[model samples]
Target: MKTLHFALPFVLIAVGCDMSPDYKQPELPVPSEWNTADDAERDSSHISAIGWKEFFTSPELQAVIDAALDNNRDLRIAVLNVEAARALYRIEKADQLLQIDAAANSSHQHLTEAEGAGPDGRTANHYQANLASTAFELDLFGRVHNESEAALETFFATEAARDAAQVTLIAETVNAYLQWLVDRETLDLLQRSLASREKSLELVTARQEIGLSSKLDLASAQAAVESVKVSRAIYSRFVEEDRNALALLIGKHDESLLPAEASLENTTILEDLPIALPSNVLLKRPDVREAEHQLKSANANIGAARAAFFPRITLTGSVGFASNDLGDLFTTEAAGAWSFIPQISIPIFDNGRNAANLDYSEVRKNIAVARYEKAIQNGFREVNNSLAARRLIREQLDAQRRLASAREEAYTLAHARYEAGLDSLLESLIAQDDMLAAQQAEIDALRQELSNTVTLYKVLGGGVLR
Candidate 1:
């Protein structure tokens, strides 16, 4: 035992070298900055540095996002996934250390007279107690170390996935809320149009009875009122459906928190969101970071696979006391014993199993590298698309607003001309139709502008760092 103890330190020193291959981060092909017509001035603060509560200034919308984060089942599952990966990492780390157990046992056996060699048969009794570590691998080739590292990387990847889920949730919630408000405003606009059309119908009817307007004019006015009614019905349906969508996003059926009578003009979402350099996306985006961690884990797996081709050594030892009498189990009369077992397993012949494992690990690493690069590429594309929209959408919204205002003025003049007997009822109806369509377009454009901003905020990896 003493000789073995003296040689243990030398044995560890001799076999301390790890057979695992050295790890290097995979190279990714990426551009330094986004390809925009004009470089956007860099913001002093990053978008991700802002929390959802701060970015979305609406108290009501912020409450909805917070509720979704808390109650959404998918977010709950993501959090649980992170916890499971963390527990798995802890288990793997624990496996790298020695496991010792204390044990006590008593045994009794009856022997026949021929076997006992006494005048009569007798029962034999035994008692034992010990501390033991069984088959603890030495990790000389770094197989265990690599596996633990892979587990740790996997845990980090899951954490990133959870963050990605959170960012998506917040964006979806905000978009749904904005859409609800826009639909409500559209419905309100249509109802007001309906009231004006009803008054026009009454005016035309009165003129026709007094022989000032023809039957054709009265019929046109009635058709205009019905058209406004149809539009109002459609918009009312949209408002209700938007409410339903918001409920689903918040993972609850509560209606009290719905955005009440809000309009595109009054709801507060920032028109200007800070843009980041394309290269920084890899660091800010959680999904991209998650993919990178997955790639790293695959790289560590390759090391574990390589180490499998080498010999594995294990050690099991026990030190204890034993006595036939229970009372003397811990006394000086008790027998003291100890054991040391050193085992080596070398792969002499395998039908290419180890080689196949190494090949599989390498293939996995290749797949992970491709996925990592693809994630970065996709992230860059999203940011570019958002930036492009950010550049042009404001112009589109401005044009839509001006068109709506001009159409409203044209409708007013047309109605006045018809009333003063200078224009046909058909002309007034046409102008009114154009005005309604223009108003609807303006509302839609406003919603689009808001949705694009939200998309940019999300694609740029906002709402994660906080």
Candidate 2:
């Protein structure tokens, strides 16, 4: 007992020696600055610092996003995963400490005469009560310590994963909502176009009956009306499909949550993202952070694997009182008893099992490193692509609007000429077709431009503040 007391300090001192390698964050593998053509004089505040509600200013969209955050199944599962990882980390940390338990037992044994008992038979009873710690390992080589560290890193990784799920969910919900609005707007446009084409067909039929227009003109007007009907049908299906998709994202079918009327132009989404921000901001992205945590966990696992090559020391002990009679077990007259069992296990040979484990840990760490780098690379590419899309889509939308305006003017002039008998009816019909196509293209371009902005915000990790 005295020897144990004297060696306790030395054991504690030895525990300070950790075999784990010092951790250092890897260098960024991307460029320092964005390569976009946009003005570099944007807001310097990080996108992640901007809350989702602040960015998505539409009340209807905010409500839908709030519902999704509360009820999304994938996000719920991510939260549960974080909790499970936290519990497992606590269990691993507890293994580094002594676990004491109280126990009491009584036993009776009978000896027969054939077993050399005196007279007929003999009976003996024993009782004991104790507080014992079973197989408490002393972390002389930091194996248990590194295991705890690995578990802690794993917990962090799970938490980051949950955040990543949340960011993705918000982005998806916003995209879905925008798509629904776009489809509705397109459907409205198609319906109006169909009505106009039908009216034109009616006019052509009346003129043909009066011998003022040819059969070809009447047939052309009919074909145009049918084409508009086909487009309207397609957009009608699109609107319903968009609603179904949005319902699944928001986790409910509450029609009141959606806007009564909305347009891509009127949907309020902030565009204050700093396009000139350094690429290092990718580190703040939840998926990238999750990958880094995983890499850190793998690094900690290598430390545990290295420690497995050293000696392990365990202690099992109990302090108790024992007596032949149960009534006397807790009395002063009972025999006082204690035990100290210290064991040391040296790794003499293991047929290369430990070596194989060390190799496996190293390989896993390498894989984690690769994944971390890949995550950063993917983030860089996404940001660049979004930036490019934002600029190009804006230009495209401008060009489409101009084209629509020109086609509208051309259609008006062609109609006037046909009414005055200066041009054929077919020329006016062609101009009308061009005007409709241009208007549809303009609407599509506007939708694409707005959708691109939402995507840019998401890829820049802008939704995590909420």
lDDT of 1 at 60: 75
Model 1 clash pairs are none
Candidate 1: C-alpha lDDT: 0.84
Per-candidate TM-scores read 0.93, 0.93
lDDT of each: 0.84, 0.86
lDDT of 1 by residue, 287-352 (tens): 988988998899889888888888899999999999999999999989997899999999889999
Cα lDDT, model 1, residue 69: 85
The worst-scoring run of ten residues by lDDT in candidate 2 lies at: 37-46
Where in model 1 is the C-alpha error above 4 Å? 1-16, 19-21, 116-120
Off by over 4 Å in 2: 1-12, 37-39, 42-44, 111-123
lDDT of 2 at 440: 82
